[model samples]
Target: MKNWIKHIVLGLNYLKSKNLIHRDVKPQNMLVANNVIFKLCDFGICGTLKDSISSTHLGSMRYLPPERLGNICSYGTRSDMWALGMSLLEVSQGYLPLSSESIMSFMSHMKNDWQPDIPTTLSQQTRDLISILLERDVNQRPRYYNDILSMSSMTTLEQNPSEDERNLIENILKSLPIPTPE
Candidate 1:
């Protein structure tokens, strides 16, 4: 999972360097090759970051950052980071972190400053990374991929988790109930 995340961050970093934002980041948009390497796709909704801001609200509603869904105006790379965090959380748990019975319900949840419940089965570093990534305040979230990579959680992960830990995570994932279509 960390390997996949690293590739996603690398992709985001490349986009950041070019002042681009992959507005629609989700599992559907992430293509995995050979069951290992991953690549972000679907650039149709990507937008350019102008002066560190983007006014357009074009992205999968479920993965959008709080600022994009609210009246906040400074949507930029941080929005993509939120989506990346959601994608990572979803991948780790085998389901979307937030589920809504209706669009209104989802909007309400987003409006209430709801934070997903990170599973305790995950390592503290993993949970810490996800928690900050999903922060409701865009200003508080790491603004750059380098900033994210610099986090102790991210840096520790880059060193590679032990094989036993990997096995334990794999087991935990296997134990999670598969989510049914809503």
Candidate 2:
């Protein structure tokens, strides 16, 4: 999970440096190989950043940040950070964090004080990182990928997946049905 986060942040850094915003930053768009390397794909909805905000709405409903939900007219990397936080939460808990049945309910839930009950097994560092990433106020979120990756705790994590995590990832991968070419 730690390595996965690092790889993702690295990818985000690269994309952001190029003035490209990956509007869709979710677990589904990420590929993990042998629980070692991670690659981000699916840039179909990506946009070029003139300053830092994009007014267009183009990302998964489940993974979008509150700002992207029209709480504001525009959003930037902070929006992607929110999705990354959700993706990490899903990975840690083995399920999507939010239970809202629709967009309206989801936005309502986000507007209120909504916090994921992170498993106790996860480290405090991980929790801290997610907390900042999931901050309701975009201003509080890490502005750039490196802002997150530069954390000492994040950089010091071991580059290994425990047996349970490996098994869980393998099972999830196996259960996903591959689509045939058209």
Candidate 3:
């Protein structure tokens, strides 16, 4: 888990350093060649730092940030962080945090500031990182890649996690409150 997160943070930082925001980051865009190796792909909706907030809705609905849903808010790299948070949740749980019936329903949920219930099985450190990454205020999110990489939990993932680590991850996934279909 740590190693997987490390690679993801590294890739995210690389993209931020290049002033690029991968507007569409989802499980589908993340290709896992092996248990320990993964790659982030699909730059179709990527935008430069200088690009203005898009009026057109883009990216996968499940991964879309709250600010993108008709709010007057302007988004930046932190928007990617929101997507990263969702991606992490997907990787850890094998499913999206929010599985709405439609894009409009998803957007409505975001507008209402609805957030997924954090899994109790996650380590305090991991939960803390996710909380900050998924904060409603984009300005409060970690700006630089190093900020995220510097996280104690993320740094630990640079190497393979032990069996105990896998157990911890599984516990966390199990703790999540599964969303029921309406």
Per-residue error for 95 in candidate 2, Å, reads: 1.3
Model 3, position 61: C-alpha lDDT score: 67
Per-residue error (Å), model 3, residue 5: 1.9
Best by lDDT: 2
For candidate 1, the clash count comes to: 0
Candidates in order have lDDT scores of: 0.78, 0.82, 0.70
lDDT digits (tens) for residues 54-166 of candidate 1: 78878888888767777576568888889888987887777886653476777778878688888887778778888888998888888779987776655666445556446
Ranking by lDDT: 2, 1, 3
Ranking by TM-score: 2, 1, 3
Give the poorly placed runs of model 1, Cα more than 4 Å off. Answer: 156-182
Indicate the residue-level lDDT of 155 in model 1. Answer: 67
Candidate 3 regions off by >4 Å? 51-57, 164-182
Give per-residue CA lDDT, model 2, range 70-115, as digits (tens): 6574758889999999998988887887653576787777766677
lDDT of 3: 0.70
Overlapping backbone residue pairs in candidate 3 total: 2
TM-score of each: 0.83, 0.88, 0.78
| Clashing residue pairs found in predicted model 1 | none
